[model samples]
Target: MAVSLTASGAAPQPDDAATELRARVERFVRTRVIPQESVLDAGGPAAGAALRELRSLARTEGLWALPLPAELGGGGLPFSVYAQLAEAEGASDHGPAALGSATLLDVTMLARHAGTRVRERYLEPLVSGEIRTCYAMTEADVPGTDPLLTGTRGGYAADGGWRITGRKWFTSGAGAADLVTVLARTSGAPGDREGLSLLLVPTDSPGFRIVRELPVLGAAGQYEIELDDVRVPGDHLIGEAGRALAVAGERLALGRTLRCLRWLGQAQRAFDLMCARAATRSGSRGALADHQLVQQHVFDALLALRTTRPLVHEAVALIAAGQDARTEVGLAKVAAARMLQQVTDSAIQVHGAAGLGPDTPLPALFRGGRAARILDGPDELHITTVARRILRDYGPQAVTPG
Candidate 1:
């Protein structure tokens, strides 16, 4: 089925092509990816080889990098179309990476702000999956959600480069990344938003070190990195100096939106598992599905999954249109994160002891759901941000007591 492109170059309505693409992704995740969860979770050369094989198959099948442009060796689909397809891919945690489409956020950011030399050096390799990159902005002593508290500093070096010094934690995928985008203060004091700048640092650079892996919910992907006088060329700065906040914000908006969609997919997966279990498992009374309490669990999980999906898509539409979606993104982020967590927890309860074990994907999904709320900015931070922005419109009249 050929997906017809709308006049605005967007997939405003799902077409045959979009439906076909989504079906292919769903099949790939269900048949190919989910079955290998155990091997993938084991984490070694065999796991790495398995992922490489999957990527090869994805490429051969023309399902690789659907979110990227054709010039970059992708399917050239717009974000709106990609969001719908991403839900299918999100059924497995490794779906995007295995399909070689995980670089969307980094690629977009670099395309917009990276210097010519930087782009020439990294862009193709990144898009082609030859190298991996990580974003480092959060610090050990600072809350990443609040960029004003950033403590890493980059000073001018005598050799016409920047000498960076600081420690960053929660740099996801840093242990295996080829490059990292580090946020450091170049001018002004800590707590000042104006002086932060983003510098691209190669993982092998002198004085750049991976301090340790900071596991999330017992998973080992995030890392703590230390930069002790790490030096990079003056051209390594992304966009204008002391403007890291602006550049980082662009990436975060898209990142958060993608995450929300992935969470929705996971939630849907858990919901399916829950319903299947309810239909088969029998208690003294009858099948678990016959119990009112179990039926309630099914209903609530479905409700959460059904409701949060559109909120996420709403944010995606705004982002694809190049419009400000802070409020919408915040709303979707909080809702989807909580929805995933709630639905996963209920699913685990339905599965009884089986859910906590490796027999099912519930444990992994539960851990990811818990981390979703905290990563990419915590729920409280997003709640306050959205509330503050919304209240500003009401003025003094809304705040005044009756």
Candidate 2:
């Protein structure tokens, strides 16, 4: 399906096919994935089994891997089209993984930079969901958002391979990942931007170890990994040596965009829950929905969601067209993260103590909303970057007293 451009340069409305696919995804998440959240959260062999069954069902229903290429066993939808679908899947925290579409970032990066040998070994399996991969760039002592402080090193080996040593924290999905894409310094000093490079390390390699699983907001899955002189084939190097930052930028832009889309979905879910609670619950003055205070909360939540969705779609459209989207993405990332946090917090207030309990998804969504501000790139980073970029357009003296 083709997506036309509006007069304002905004994204076109979804065609009939896109709308149908989105409804199918929503139904699947609501009926199949939501019912399995308890099992998925318990984190055991049974959870894994249940998730695998869900993935199989998603595939059977033709709802798997919507963003990947058709030749790579995906639905081949463009990012502009997939943005809406992603929001639907994002309603449940486990929706993306359950539907087998969470590997888009890794898959896109590898397809662009990996050599024939590496691609032949990993790409197909990753695309087909036969194996999972993780991106390990952050370190325990340094801020991951700043690539210049990278402490990991990969030196030449006598056997023509490379010996890599580093420690990374917040490596999501590492416990179950088969391979990890590591960023290491190959020729530059500690703060030099020119000497970093990307390497593909198999989880079974000699010195690779999972130190511990690092929980975020009390949820498990992220990990702290240690690589002590792990040796990888020379051919495992991705793209040119000393160019990791450029390749990583490509992934981050799209990653942030996808994240914004997901955050909107979560915000919408929380908003729905809030309204339902307000309508059904009893308060001092009849139904909670009848209270002016309750109406204000609903109105504010609706405003945040509506304001943030278009910014996300604009960023998605730029990314899909291969245009520069740093500014738009920065705006969307911060806006969506804040929107989710606000809407979810309001939802929790509307539900009173029940929102904090295990019976509802508010607690999980609240935690995710809080983390969304800090991950990918923190709010401060994006704010600073966007401000400086915008300032460049008016020159230093153009805003004297305006």
Residue 106 lDDT (model 2): 89
| TM-scores of all predicted structures | 0.95, 0.97
> Residue pairs in steric clash, candidate 1?
none
Q: What is the Å distance of residue 350 in model 1 from its true position?
A: 0.9
Candidate-wise lDDT, in order: 0.88, 0.91
Clashes of 1: 0
lDDT for position 74 in model 2:
87
lDDT string for model 2 (53-78, tens) is: 99999999999988887888888888
lDDT of prediction 2: 0.91
Give the candidate number with the greatest TM-score.
2
